[model samples]
Target: MDYYKVNSKNLSLLKERVSVPTYDRTNVKAGILHIGIGGFHRAHEAFYTDELLNKNSNSNWGICGVALLSFDQRIYQTLKDQNGLYTLIVKELDGTLTKTIIGSIVDYLFAPENPIAVIERIANPEIKIITLTITEGGYNYNEATGEFEIENPSIQKDLKNPNDPKTVFGYLTQGLKLRKENNVSGCTIQSCDNIQGNGHVTKKMLLSYVKHAEPELVSWIESHVSFPNSMVDRITPATVSADMAALKETSGIEDAWPVVCEPFKQWVIEDDFIAGRPAWEKVGAQFVEDVVPYEKMKLSLLNAGHSVLGILGTLIGYSTIDEVVNDTVVSAFLEAYMEQEVIPTLGDLEGVDLNEYKKSLLQRFGNIYIKDQVDRICSESSAKIPKFMLPTVQSQLKDGGSIELAAFVIASWAIYSLGVDENGTKIPIKDAVKAVLHEKAVAAKSNPKAFLDIESIFGSLADSESFVEVFTKSYQNIMQFGVKKCLIDLNSKF
Candidate 1:
């Protein structure tokens, strides 16, 4: 027999590999308009929604996936080509693989091509919730001023042509403007980004953006809209053509774009939707009053562990996260840092075990099949630090807790940001502020204090004498003694 296709013809063949959606996708209503439909979105939110749709008959929540930026070209075209049907493969530590054909995405639009269509879709009374997964750097943030960059090129363009907006902020504000004009009800804007106070930050950024773009629309939005903070977690790696081939080989289904992730997934959402929402809680999703405890734990421990392994892994000559976490020294450093420095700053949960979570993170990072690239993990050092590790550092510094390991992680990034590893090979820096990082990194080699001068990443930490001393010493030590020796020595502190 020939290979199975993802369409209706090969349902029997596909059944062995994936749990295909049985519900009539045509009957599903577009209740959520999700922006930034990337791999993370497909694996996390789409997976959750797929479950809810499959289990419940009364749910009307189908996602209208929208690609807002130019970088989403590959995914936009792929999803369009596949008719929004793709395979998700969850890889386990023991080599057990489970596949699911997700069908929650009923429609998709590349917003850059037709911004007006996207805005109009957003204004639809049926779209009760709008979600986002745009990275931290995507927001129009001015690190120096600590406000939304109201005059950003995109925002400026959107302001002049609010009817046909380009930016996500523009599309949303204008969509709300249209909704207000039509006397439609307000919708929820839920942010799935890893930033702390994600909902609060989003509300502030949007309010700031709309203030400059549409002044009158601001007051109406303030009363009608809701910004719900969420904590989303899953270790979904970058899927190349190899992953697609793997799905084809294993399942005999030719999926254009396949998503591969760790077996673990988590979403803790604040139940604050302005419009009616999905009964996602019926299908393993946690609905809580406050997502702060879960968010802080995830960001501080898991994400911060990635930061440690990422920069240190590169400097120490490891390529992937598994390789980095497999190293006893790197793994030990992360565990110690979390228990002593990171965990101290997090709030205690009712039923969750913190130590088990930490251990599980190590196992997830050490998953052989995931093959999460350390360079990819460490790619955007400037952004990851402030979100994942800075909260812990800031909190630890205030309480006089152990920050030696945290200081070492930052020092490792400064050294790695120099664009050369310990082996004298060129390293690639892929940060939003790469130019500034490169400049300061080169200077920081001789004078580590210079790296801390990047106020956006480091803030006022450079001014503190004690922090300066610890960070400078660590950077110098890493440069002189190398990563393994420095980390091994740092572990001796505990």
Candidate 2:
């Protein structure tokens, strides 16, 4: 129970006392190589792997985590200091909490110090799956084409010298080359990013690297590698002092690397793996033939809904999803937005009731205990917009439908680009177009096209007259009337 010490006894006590699920951690082999070792990956995929290990005594699905970015050294040291152990706290709406010690991670590799070593391990015949949580931006994609940016400096270096490239794609291609050279069959590359058709996107990126870097390897990867699309849902907020205090009170263990997430967790994976997979379904994972419809539903409705709350939440001076969801106006706006704008664009899918899904989404957003930060949800709007909002906008416009809500969301994004929140406090905007956006905002006065004109983010959609008119009108309204008033006007349209 000592705060400063972490040993097996304390870990076991914390798990037992907190009602954390303990897994049979011995028999699982290191088959999966995870690229990102961040909070969500630990709370979601790692948690799932832990459950699988607990159920199946002899599972072969342990994960070896690889950190590509420079900041990973601290994470590497933290996990290594604790002997590859960390606690995940799942907080519920009514103040209920459950803490679990995740042990599915068997090894760790820092890219800068041990890139080749990591690549070699990835090529191992026993390693049958390479999964990634490398975020939407980490793929080094060309914003205009949504393909892997081949001219990326890291990628260029990798192509010039396959033995050493700092990028994830570079490491992956190198590993695949090793696999081919050693006659070891290729592994399934499962992309867990929030992008729609994540697997296909990952394939395109990887194959793009292969085409120039290793053409022979490209053919083998095309034929052998299985890139399965997956929909991963979990609301994990950035850690705060309150979370640390809660962990201290509950676990009596001071965890420097503790992760706090909502009690709700969902993983819908396509049942496609080249070298086979674990019985993850036993651990409450949904396995289906095609994950596109489900992915679209979740991405457009749930994720996009979160974006709506995030931007508007910050603008309204709310700190968390729970806070924003409780505001009557915000809550009603989201409900109307989803029902009118998002749902109509979605095609029906088997085993999914759209109405029920919307209801559940509202409930999840209202779970006050989750404390999901608006800044966290709103950070990567540039990457997220295309996936979560654009498809719906395009569909609605093509059908000559009203896009009041969607347009408002775009206007909010432009407002966000102004670099100030409701209280006149500056909110840090992180995007590839941050500098240009700030300049444009200075000149254009919260004009939506100012941000959209960054052709990389919107592609040719920026030039569409219908989109321009709708978005421009919405932006002008928001600038004149503000978010709350704009919401009132949007509702009047219904």
User: Candidate 2: which stretches are off by over 4 Å?
Assistant: 1-4, 7-9, 12-16, 19-27, 446-448
| Deviation (Å) of 186 in candidate 2 | 1.9
Could you say which candidate leads in lDDT? Answer: 1
**lDDT of each residue in 261-363, candidate 1, tens digit only:** 9999999999999887898888888999988888888888888898889889888788899999999988888899988998888767877899999889988
In angstroms, give how far residue 373 of model 2 lies from its true place: 1.2
TM-score of each: 0.97, 0.95
Question: Which candidate number has the best TM-score?
Answer: 1
Cα error of candidate 1 at position 180, Å: 0.7
Error of 2 at 399 (Å): 1.3
Report the lDDT tens digits of candidate 2 across residue range 1-494. Answer: 56543444466666555544365555557888899999999999999888877765446789888888888898888777766678888887688887777888877888889778988988999899999998888777866788677777777787787777788888998899899999998789999889889998899988887888878888889888999999999888887888878788766867778888888888999999989887888888999888888889999999999999999988877888889988878888888988988888887788889999898888888887888888888887888887888888888988887677887787778888788986788887877667876776665574457667777777777778877887788878777777888777666766
